[model samples]
Target: MMTMPTISNQNGAFPLLRKTELRRLLTEKQLQQLEQFCRASSKRAGSTLFRQGDPADTFHLLADGMVELRARPPGRRVYRTVELIGPSCTFGDEALFGETTYLTSSRVLETARVLALTRPAFDRLAANHPDIALGVLRCAGNCLIKTIRRSAILTQAPADVGLRMLLEELAGGNGNGAPIPVRITHAQLAGVLHVSRETVSRMLGQLASEGTVEVGRGIIRISSH
Candidate 1:
């Protein structure tokens, strides 16, 4: 059975979305109209928002917390996390553009609030407001570019270098001395790096031994020294 989202009252009071890429693309009027289509909901951690291959019927905007996009290739026991969606970002645009099914499964990584618009609603909005449609297209294009770049990195870089680059990104290039704020598992890191969990564990251990990083339960702190 398909799960229904738990609805909440937002009353179009989401100011954060106005600071995102969507705001850059949409005019004030368009933004207001777009919000009119939204219905807010709250999801608990570990809840699956939608599964891969499910019928694409809605688009979502993360109002708070995190969501992970994972894709399971056929005959594979594990799913790779393709992207992490954070607050103020939108997802599920593939559905708006006529995709029949979701390309990846979305699962909540933390307690989250989301604003959703059904495909039909999005289509109507797009039909009436060409600027909103254009903005969404640009956003989707940017996401595609990032995905392509990540694929290139995974294929071209050595596992350790790729892992380091990923850590640096998570750490926000804090001079290699600051802790990466996000906590992740070896399995998830393995998926992102296109490597095995054992490989990730071994590399992390080596880094820890070298004083390059400090590993704790669910955390890895990079050493700036």
Candidate 2:
């Protein structure tokens, strides 16, 4: 069993988590109780946080930086990125509801500060605070529903349409007028879009020529005009 480290106020981890959506659902006293159950860690880019099939014993919250959730279908050679979790997002929430194993692996994409609560601690919290537990469950359920809808919509679309939709989503639906806030590579985009890297590159090139977008090293920006 993995042991949780003692939490302290010196690291200022509580204030960081307080700004996340999770905090909105929890009262100040509940938040303080939550802090008691969490342990903080700093991870470097490229570090694997957890792997699919691993025991889902902890739930994680990203206090800073980014992480990617990826999955390798059985017998598949390459992993597909299912989601890119930014700061203030929580992952592994399923563990709180009795999930035994992780469905996807998570990797840090940048230097990240993370706070995690063990399943035992979470169960205790849920047992003691029904309101907080209900709120967290609702939040997790909504996120799961959104992810399901996005996957269903994207998978049913033609590759080109899916690609465009993805780009728009990354741009926060600011139309084609705003630059995508995140830097991404063609291969990474391919993984998310479930297309070949060559296909992604060729399509991007076509979009560039048509003045729909501009692609550069590790970046793709939608044109305002």
Candidate 3:
């Protein structure tokens, strides 16, 4: 089997997960105890830890690495990139809506380590640790609000506008340089832009012709010009 290339971080093996409000939100008695049983598990690049429509009773805390939340749109061979999650992130809270299935699959973009906790386990813990559960609920609520906002933006914005928004977001992320070195495939860009691969290529060609961007084999650079 072919092996994938490894990308190393400047600081350490993985990005540091700082103590943010998100982390603090999960620090209740239930989460504190769940933390004790926490086993950090890792996966290889291009690996999928969970698939869409799978059971969603557990919450996964991504301790390290990047994950892509994807969905296979009807009649499409491609899995669209719905969201990109980084370290110190939690996923699968959609299950709390009493839904038995997941809305999207979680795939590993790189080697990843995650802490998994089931809803039953969290519930038992939360029964005695109400404050932590409340905090967790609040965190989930915030995520839902953000999702709503993103949906509104996508629905109202033009394709180029949406793509530019994503570019700015990636460029502003920590550790990314001014040139915004984003190396991704055209197909990947299609997924991100919620367009067909052909559309992505055509739009990208237009951008390049306009001197607004440059595209190589699988990488694209949004230029300042």
Backbone-clash count (model 2) = 0
lDDT of 2 at 207: 83
Alpha carbon deviation, residue 189, candidate 3 (Å): 3.2
lDDT of 1 by residue, 21-85 (tens): 67777787777777776676778777788988899998887777777889998999777887767
lDDT of 3 by residue, 1-225 (tens): 122333432332122222223465654444545454334466676867678778887776666666778898888886788776656556777655577888888877656766655778677657866676676567667766766687578647898787777665544354433344455667766676667889877877887898766778755676543
Per-residue lDDT of model 2, residues 78-191, tens digit only: 788878676666788758877899988888766778888788877787788767767666656666676678778777899889888877666545555565544667887788
| Regions of candidate 2 where Cα sits further than 4 Å from its true position | 1-10, 171-181, 210-214, 221-225
lDDT of 2 at 204: 90
Off by over 4 Å in 3: 1-21, 24-34, 73-78, 87-89, 175-178, 206-225
Q: Which ten residues in a row have the lowest lDDT in candidate 1?
A: 7-16
> Considering every candidate listed, which one attains the maximal TM-score?
1
- State each model's C-alpha RMSD to the native: 3.2, 4.2, 5.1
TM-score for each candidate, following the candidate numbering: 0.82, 0.78, 0.72
| Backbone collisions counted per model | 2, 0, 0
